[model samples]
Target: MQRMAAIDPIAYGANRNHYDGAVTRLSPYLRHGVLSLKEVSEHVIALVPTPRSADKLLQELAWRDYYRRVLGERGDAVREDLEPYKTGYQPSDYADALPADFLAAQTGNDFVDATVRELHETGYLHNQGRMKIAAYVVHWRRVKWQAGAAWMYAHLLDGDLASNHLSWQWVASTFAAKPYLFNLDNLLRWTGGRFTGCDADGRSPFDASYDELNRRLFA
Candidate 1:
């Protein structure tokens, strides 16, 4: 209740994607049924002068409900791919487990190494952190989405079958309209310069443009 009361929907909608954004941090409660989407939506809607002012925050809450509905409809299949890899690779081609470099937090990318350390130490990653790390694992490392999802699920405090697995599918282009990708500029922008998006060698695979990334990542 106290956390719910402290939510600032306007701030959340405006800046939720940054590394140090005003995220509500209510997922563990919401995931465990301590709070419902309806309740949170109602609280947020009441705070904003107009409903549109809270659309971003409300839309995110609705996503939780959407994932749950998909889970109910699909059952165990959510653990598997809902669609083919839009990245031009077959399911069998991807690795079955995370590579040792990632587990050791030595992925050669400073941003990713920091993200891995944060995930292990805190068990809670921001939405951007989750998406990018999953991107690194599934897309960059060419590992299977299930491998990355299971790795994260084992450590997340807010992990849920619907939310976690579905999200991994999205990043891997098995659920989303396109494969999610990011470059050095994206990391520098969202992270407030916290990570250089480069390794100690001062070079990065993510230093390329999106067109180049697509060409490199796909077949």
Candidate 2:
């Protein structure tokens, strides 16, 4: 039997959301034995009232349970070089072009820099920002997914090895049929111009040059 120490209930409350303002103050309780997952799910059901919201909360909790199971099943294989679809794969001659400046928010591209800074400072990033950042690292910078996964594991406060590692591989096209990339215009709109892919008036970096940022990054 595994003995565990008590944790605060507040940590779980805060981490319900996966963003900057997440109130993950109740997670510790759920993580340890301070509170039970069944109790938490029931309590949320009671408070939410509406079936939709209650179901959503329940689903999220279930996902945590699923991840826990997967971790137990994979164990060492989680990080092992098990290229599922490869025929004769060997870890050799990887081409990684990740830039230190980019990871440090010194890339000079406001959109990319701001996203990295947000993740670094708050230990979280909005879902859109997550996609964009991943796209930038893989499509724009041409870095290996393993490298990017390592960087995220070192930063994100709520980082899960199962989710983070696999998601990185999916975005980089190693685990997916094609690479995941998003247009620069959508990136600007999602962050509400905070990162500003263009100008103050919603102009894109490609407006003058037919939006060649995509070609420059992906090419």
lDDT of 1 by residue, 15-102 (tens): 9999888899999999889998888899999999999999999999989999999999999999999998999899998999999999
Give the alpha carbon lDDT tens digit for every residue of 26-81 in model 2: 43455554766687766665654463555544665676676567668877565644
Q: Which 10 residues in a row give candidate 1 its minimum summed lDDT? A: 182-191
Top lDDT prediction, candidate number: 1
What TM-score does model 2 achieve against the real structure? Answer: 0.64
All candidates: TM-score = 0.97, 0.64
> What are the C-alpha RMSDs, in order, of all predicted structures?
0.9, 7.2
C-alpha lDDT values of all predictions: 0.91, 0.58
Deviation from truth (RMSD, Å), model 1: 0.9
